[model samples]
Target: LAALLAPGNFIVMGAALLLNGFAVAPTLTAGLAAAERSVVEKRKTEVLAWAISALNLGGALPPAITGYIIDTQGVSVAFVIPLVCMSLSVVMILPYLNIWREKVREIPA
Candidate 1:
Protein backbone atom coordinates (compact mmCIF):
# COMPACT_ATOMS: atom_id res chain seq x y z
CA LEU A 1 0.00 0.00 0.00
CA ALA A 2 2.78 2.40 0.84
CA ALA A 3 4.36 1.53 -2.46
CA LEU A 4 1.24 2.51 -4.30
CA LEU A 5 1.49 6.23 -3.56
CA ALA A 6 3.20 8.51 -6.07
CA PRO A 7 3.54 12.28 -6.19
CA GLY A 8 0.51 13.25 -8.29
CA ASN A 9 -1.80 10.26 -8.31
CA PHE A 10 -5.06 11.31 -6.70
CA ILE A 11 -6.71 7.97 -7.35
CA VAL A 12 -3.98 6.02 -5.65
CA MET A 13 -3.85 8.46 -2.74
CA GLY A 14 -7.62 8.33 -2.32
CA ALA A 15 -7.60 4.54 -2.44
CA ALA A 16 -4.82 4.42 0.12
CA LEU A 17 -6.66 6.82 2.38
CA LEU A 18 -9.87 4.78 2.15
CA LEU A 19 -8.08 1.52 2.83
CA ASN A 20 -6.10 3.12 5.63
CA GLY A 21 -9.34 4.32 7.19
CA PHE A 22 -10.73 0.82 7.16
CA ALA A 23 -7.54 -0.58 8.68
CA VAL A 24 -7.21 1.99 11.47
CA ALA A 25 -10.89 2.16 12.47
CA PRO A 26 -10.86 -1.07 14.43
CA THR A 27 -7.39 -0.68 15.94
CA LEU A 28 -8.22 1.14 19.15
CA THR A 29 -11.17 -0.99 20.15
CA ALA A 30 -9.49 -4.23 19.22
CA GLY A 31 -6.27 -3.20 20.88
CA LEU A 32 -7.96 -2.31 24.16
CA ALA A 33 -10.04 -5.48 24.12
CA ALA A 34 -6.96 -7.58 23.54
CA ALA A 35 -5.08 -5.73 26.22
CA GLU A 36 -7.90 -6.31 28.67
CA ARG A 37 -8.08 -9.98 27.77
CA SER A 38 -4.35 -10.53 28.08
CA VAL A 39 -3.99 -9.29 31.64
CA VAL A 40 -4.98 -10.85 34.96
CA GLU A 41 -8.08 -9.65 36.78
CA LYS A 42 -6.09 -7.85 39.48
CA ARG A 43 -3.94 -5.97 36.98
CA LYS A 44 -6.56 -5.30 34.36
CA THR A 45 -7.08 -1.67 35.30
CA GLU A 46 -3.38 -0.91 35.38
CA VAL A 47 -2.86 -2.70 32.07
CA LEU A 48 -5.77 -0.81 30.53
CA ALA A 49 -4.46 2.47 31.82
CA TRP A 50 -1.15 1.82 30.17
CA ALA A 51 -2.93 0.75 27.01
CA ILE A 52 -4.90 3.99 26.94
CA SER A 53 -1.76 6.02 27.48
CA ALA A 54 0.00 4.13 24.73
CA LEU A 55 -2.92 4.67 22.43
CA ASN A 56 -2.93 8.36 23.16
CA LEU A 57 0.78 8.64 22.60
CA GLY A 58 0.58 6.60 19.42
CA GLY A 59 -2.22 8.77 18.14
CA ALA A 60 -0.48 12.02 18.95
CA LEU A 61 3.11 11.37 18.00
CA PRO A 62 2.93 9.94 14.50
CA PRO A 63 1.67 12.93 12.54
CA ALA A 64 4.59 15.08 13.63
CA ILE A 65 7.05 12.37 12.71
CA THR A 66 5.27 11.73 9.44
CA GLY A 67 5.18 15.44 8.67
CA TYR A 68 8.90 15.66 9.26
CA ILE A 69 9.42 12.72 7.01
CA ILE A 70 7.26 14.29 4.36
CA ASP A 71 9.20 17.54 4.54
CA THR A 72 12.62 15.92 4.35
CA GLN A 73 12.01 12.82 2.27
CA GLY A 74 8.71 13.05 0.31
CA VAL A 75 5.17 11.85 0.70
CA SER A 76 5.95 8.50 -0.88
CA VAL A 77 8.62 7.74 1.68
CA ALA A 78 6.52 9.15 4.51
CA PHE A 79 3.85 6.58 3.79
CA VAL A 80 6.22 3.88 4.91
CA ILE A 81 6.16 5.08 8.51
CA PRO A 82 2.81 3.48 9.28
CA LEU A 83 3.84 0.24 7.66
CA VAL A 84 7.05 0.17 9.66
CA CYS A 85 5.26 1.05 12.87
CA MET A 86 2.66 -1.64 12.26
CA SER A 87 5.36 -4.22 11.63
CA LEU A 88 7.27 -3.23 14.73
CA SER A 89 4.08 -3.32 16.77
CA VAL A 90 3.41 -6.86 15.61
CA VAL A 91 6.93 -7.84 16.52
CA MET A 92 6.58 -6.25 19.94
CA ILE A 93 3.47 -8.33 20.68
CA LEU A 94 4.74 -11.63 19.35
CA PRO A 95 6.19 -12.65 22.73
CA TYR A 96 2.77 -12.29 24.32
CA LEU A 97 0.76 -14.06 21.63
CA ASN A 98 0.50 -17.31 23.58
CA ILE A 99 -0.72 -15.50 26.67
CA TRP A 100 -3.22 -13.55 24.63
CA ARG A 101 -4.46 -16.71 22.96
CA GLU A 102 -4.95 -18.54 26.23
CA LYS A 103 -6.69 -15.59 27.83
CA VAL A 104 -9.04 -15.09 24.92
CA ARG A 105 -9.81 -18.79 24.69
CA GLU A 106 -10.83 -18.90 28.34
CA ILE A 107 -13.65 -16.40 27.80
CA PRO A 108 -17.05 -18.18 27.76
CA ALA A 109 -19.38 -17.83 24.80
Candidate 2:
Protein backbone atom coordinates (compact mmCIF):
# COMPACT_ATOMS: atom_id res chain seq x y z
CA LEU A 1 0.00 0.00 0.00
CA ALA A 2 2.85 2.36 0.74
CA ALA A 3 4.28 1.80 -2.74
CA LEU A 4 0.87 2.64 -4.14
CA LEU A 5 1.14 6.05 -2.54
CA ALA A 6 3.46 7.72 -5.03
CA PRO A 7 3.07 11.44 -5.67
CA GLY A 8 0.59 10.99 -8.51
CA ASN A 9 -1.52 8.52 -6.57
CA PHE A 10 -1.31 10.59 -3.39
CA ILE A 11 -3.38 13.39 -4.86
CA VAL A 12 -6.17 11.10 -5.91
CA MET A 13 -6.04 9.18 -2.66
CA GLY A 14 -6.26 12.41 -0.68
CA ALA A 15 -9.23 13.60 -2.72
CA ALA A 16 -10.94 10.23 -2.36
CA LEU A 17 -10.46 10.21 1.39
CA LEU A 18 -11.75 13.77 1.66
CA LEU A 19 -14.83 12.98 -0.38
CA ASN A 20 -15.46 9.71 1.48
CA GLY A 21 -15.08 11.38 4.86
CA PHE A 22 -17.52 14.12 3.91
CA ALA A 23 -20.08 11.62 2.64
CA VAL A 24 -19.76 9.16 5.52
CA ALA A 25 -19.61 11.56 8.45
CA PRO A 26 -23.15 12.84 8.08
CA THR A 27 -24.58 9.46 7.14
CA LEU A 28 -23.18 8.01 10.34
CA THR A 29 -24.50 10.88 12.42
CA ALA A 30 -27.94 10.75 10.84
CA GLY A 31 -28.08 6.99 11.21
CA LEU A 32 -27.31 7.30 14.89
CA ALA A 33 -29.99 9.96 15.28
CA ALA A 34 -32.53 7.93 13.36
CA ALA A 35 -31.89 4.88 15.49
CA GLU A 36 -32.18 6.92 18.64
CA ARG A 37 -35.36 8.64 17.48
CA SER A 38 -36.96 5.37 16.43
CA VAL A 39 -36.36 3.63 19.74
CA VAL A 40 -39.41 2.93 21.93
CA GLU A 41 -39.07 2.90 25.68
CA LYS A 42 -41.22 -0.15 26.18
CA ARG A 43 -40.24 -2.22 23.17
CA LYS A 44 -36.53 -2.45 23.65
CA THR A 45 -36.20 -5.77 21.83
CA GLU A 46 -37.95 -4.54 18.68
CA VAL A 47 -35.93 -1.34 18.58
CA LEU A 48 -32.70 -3.24 19.10
CA ALA A 49 -33.59 -5.60 16.30
CA TRP A 50 -34.36 -2.77 13.93
CA ALA A 51 -31.19 -0.88 14.76
CA ILE A 52 -29.04 -3.98 14.51
CA SER A 53 -30.62 -4.96 11.22
CA ALA A 54 -29.99 -1.54 9.82
CA LEU A 55 -26.41 -1.45 11.04
CA ASN A 56 -25.71 -4.95 9.77
CA LEU A 57 -27.34 -4.30 6.41
CA GLY A 58 -25.50 -1.02 5.93
CA GLY A 59 -22.22 -2.68 6.89
CA ALA A 60 -22.77 -5.68 4.64
CA LEU A 61 -23.78 -4.18 1.29
CA PRO A 62 -20.82 -1.98 0.41
CA PRO A 63 -18.05 -4.53 0.80
CA ALA A 64 -19.91 -7.12 -1.24
CA ILE A 65 -20.49 -4.70 -4.11
CA THR A 66 -16.95 -3.44 -3.99
CA GLY A 67 -15.57 -6.93 -3.68
CA TYR A 68 -17.38 -8.06 -6.80
CA ILE A 69 -16.17 -5.02 -8.69
CA ILE A 70 -12.61 -5.63 -7.56
CA ASP A 71 -12.70 -9.31 -8.42
CA THR A 72 -13.75 -8.53 -11.99
CA GLN A 73 -11.63 -5.44 -12.49
CA GLY A 74 -8.24 -4.52 -11.09
CA VAL A 75 -7.49 -2.88 -7.74
CA SER A 76 -6.95 0.66 -9.07
CA VAL A 77 -10.27 0.65 -10.88
CA ALA A 78 -11.92 -0.87 -7.85
CA PHE A 79 -10.61 1.96 -5.73
CA VAL A 80 -11.98 4.54 -8.15
CA ILE A 81 -15.41 2.95 -8.19
CA PRO A 82 -16.13 3.91 -4.57
CA LEU A 83 -15.58 7.58 -5.38
CA VAL A 84 -18.32 7.39 -7.98
CA CYS A 85 -20.62 5.55 -5.60
CA MET A 86 -19.88 8.04 -2.83
CA SER A 87 -20.63 10.94 -5.18
CA LEU A 88 -23.96 9.39 -6.06
CA SER A 89 -24.66 8.78 -2.40
CA VAL A 90 -24.04 12.46 -1.76
CA VAL A 91 -26.49 13.41 -4.50
CA MET A 92 -29.11 11.02 -3.16
CA ILE A 93 -28.73 12.45 0.31
CA LEU A 94 -29.02 16.08 -0.78
CA PRO A 95 -32.80 16.01 -1.00
CA TYR A 96 -33.01 14.56 2.51
CA LEU A 97 -30.77 17.20 4.05
CA ASN A 98 -33.86 19.06 5.14
CA ILE A 99 -35.13 15.97 6.91
CA TRP A 100 -31.80 15.63 8.68
CA ARG A 101 -31.88 19.27 9.61
CA GLU A 102 -35.35 18.87 11.08
CA LYS A 103 -34.17 15.90 13.12
CA VAL A 104 -31.22 17.84 14.41
CA ARG A 105 -33.49 20.71 15.36
CA GLU A 106 -35.57 18.32 17.44
CA ILE A 107 -32.64 17.53 19.69
CA PRO A 108 -33.33 18.91 23.15
CA ALA A 109 -31.18 21.55 24.75
Candidate 3:
Protein backbone atom coordinates (compact mmCIF):
# COMPACT_ATOMS: atom_id res chain seq x y z
CA LEU A 1 0.00 0.00 0.00
CA ALA A 2 2.79 2.40 0.78
CA ALA A 3 4.27 1.52 -2.57
CA LEU A 4 1.13 2.83 -4.22
CA LEU A 5 2.11 6.32 -3.16
CA ALA A 6 5.28 6.39 -5.21
CA PRO A 7 3.42 7.36 -8.35
CA GLY A 8 2.06 10.48 -6.70
CA ASN A 9 -1.22 10.33 -8.57
CA PHE A 10 -4.44 11.65 -7.11
CA ILE A 11 -6.28 8.34 -7.30
CA VAL A 12 -3.52 6.37 -5.66
CA MET A 13 -2.96 9.09 -3.10
CA GLY A 14 -6.64 9.10 -2.19
CA ALA A 15 -6.76 5.33 -2.00
CA ALA A 16 -3.64 5.26 0.17
CA LEU A 17 -5.00 7.94 2.43
CA LEU A 18 -8.33 6.13 2.74
CA LEU A 19 -6.66 2.87 3.59
CA ASN A 20 -4.32 4.59 6.02
CA GLY A 21 -7.28 6.29 7.69
CA PHE A 22 -8.88 2.92 8.34
CA ALA A 23 -5.65 1.65 9.85
CA VAL A 24 -4.91 4.64 12.06
CA ALA A 25 -7.42 4.00 14.80
CA PRO A 26 -6.69 0.33 15.30
CA THR A 27 -2.94 0.85 15.03
CA LEU A 28 -2.91 3.64 17.58
CA THR A 29 -5.10 1.69 19.98
CA ALA A 30 -3.09 -1.49 19.71
CA GLY A 31 0.22 0.35 19.98
CA LEU A 32 -0.81 2.04 23.17
CA ALA A 33 -2.32 -1.14 24.50
CA ALA A 34 0.87 -3.05 23.84
CA ALA A 35 2.92 -0.36 25.50
CA GLU A 36 0.64 -0.50 28.50
CA ARG A 37 1.00 -4.26 28.70
CA SER A 38 4.75 -4.46 28.19
CA VAL A 39 5.70 -2.81 31.42
CA VAL A 40 5.26 -3.40 35.13
CA GLU A 41 2.11 -1.98 36.67
CA LYS A 42 3.92 1.03 38.02
CA ARG A 43 5.52 2.10 34.75
CA LYS A 44 2.46 1.62 32.58
CA THR A 45 1.50 5.25 32.97
CA GLU A 46 4.97 6.44 32.09
CA VAL A 47 5.11 4.11 29.13
CA LEU A 48 1.82 5.32 27.74
CA ALA A 49 2.90 8.89 28.18
CA TRP A 50 6.10 8.15 26.35
CA ALA A 51 4.19 6.36 23.62
CA ILE A 52 2.00 9.40 23.13
CA SER A 53 4.97 11.68 23.28
CA ALA A 54 6.72 9.62 20.67
CA LEU A 55 3.63 9.78 18.48
CA ASN A 56 3.64 13.53 18.80
CA LEU A 57 7.35 13.71 18.13
CA GLY A 58 7.00 11.42 15.15
CA GLY A 59 4.23 13.60 13.82
CA ALA A 60 6.20 16.74 14.43
CA LEU A 61 9.54 15.70 12.99
CA PRO A 62 8.93 14.34 9.49
CA PRO A 63 7.67 17.36 7.65
CA ALA A 64 10.93 19.26 7.53
CA ILE A 65 12.74 16.50 5.65
CA THR A 66 9.72 15.59 3.56
CA GLY A 67 9.14 19.20 2.75
CA TYR A 68 12.74 19.54 1.72
CA ILE A 69 12.38 16.52 -0.49
CA ILE A 70 9.16 17.80 -1.96
CA ASP A 71 10.66 21.18 -2.61
CA THR A 72 13.90 20.00 -4.16
CA GLN A 73 13.05 16.54 -5.47
CA GLY A 74 9.28 16.35 -6.03
CA VAL A 75 6.24 14.86 -4.36
CA SER A 76 6.86 11.47 -5.90
CA VAL A 77 10.28 11.32 -4.30
CA ALA A 78 8.85 12.42 -1.01
CA PHE A 79 6.47 9.49 -1.09
CA VAL A 80 9.34 7.07 -1.55
CA ILE A 81 10.55 7.69 1.98
CA PRO A 82 7.49 5.94 3.37
CA LEU A 83 8.03 2.97 1.11
CA VAL A 84 11.61 2.71 2.29
CA CYS A 85 10.62 3.14 5.91
CA MET A 86 7.90 0.51 5.61
CA SER A 87 10.31 -1.94 4.08
CA LEU A 88 12.87 -1.26 6.79
CA SER A 89 10.21 -1.62 9.44
CA VAL A 90 9.19 -5.00 8.05
CA VAL A 91 12.77 -6.16 8.05
CA MET A 92 13.32 -4.89 11.56
CA ILE A 93 10.30 -6.84 12.81
CA LEU A 94 11.21 -10.04 11.00
CA PRO A 95 13.17 -11.24 14.03
CA TYR A 96 9.93 -11.30 16.00
CA LEU A 97 7.88 -13.09 13.37
CA ASN A 98 7.31 -16.12 15.52
CA ILE A 99 6.06 -14.07 18.41
CA TRP A 100 3.77 -12.18 16.06
CA ARG A 101 2.32 -15.36 14.64
CA GLU A 102 1.79 -16.83 18.08
CA LYS A 103 -0.43 -14.01 19.27
CA VAL A 104 -1.54 -12.44 16.01
CA ARG A 105 -5.22 -13.15 16.53
CA GLU A 106 -7.07 -14.34 19.61
CA ILE A 107 -10.66 -14.41 18.37
CA PRO A 108 -11.97 -17.94 17.98
CA ALA A 109 -12.82 -18.96 14.48
Question: Largest TM-score belongs to which candidate?
Answer: 1
Which numbered prediction scores highest in lDDT against the true structure?
Answer: 1
List clashing residue pairs in candidate 1. Answer: none
RMSD of 3: 4.4
Residue 59 of model 2: what lDDT? 88
Where is model 3 poorest over a 10-residue stretch in terms of lDDT? 100-109
Stretches > 4 Å off in candidate 3: 1-12, 95-109
For candidate 1, write residues 1-109 as lDDT tens digits.
5345475778788887889799876977787887787767999999999988987998899999899889999877876787899899899989989987888898765
Task: State the lDDT of candidate 2 residue by residue for 1-109, as single tens digits.
Answer: 3225654687777876788789977977767667576445576567667777977886899899888888888667775775787799899989988986786677664
Clashes per model (N, Cα, C within 3 A): 0, 0, 0
Off by over 4 Å in 1: 2-7, 40-43, 74-76
Candidate 1 lowest-lDDT run of ten: 1-10
User: In lDDT terms, how accurate is model 3?
Assistant: 0.77
lDDT of 3 at 63: 81
Model 2 lDDT, residue 92, Cα: 93
Q: Counting only residues 3 or more apart in sequence or on different chains, how many pairs clash (N, Cα, C under 3 Å) in candidate 3?
A: 0
CA deviation > 4 Å runs, candidate 2: 1-4, 7-30, 38-51
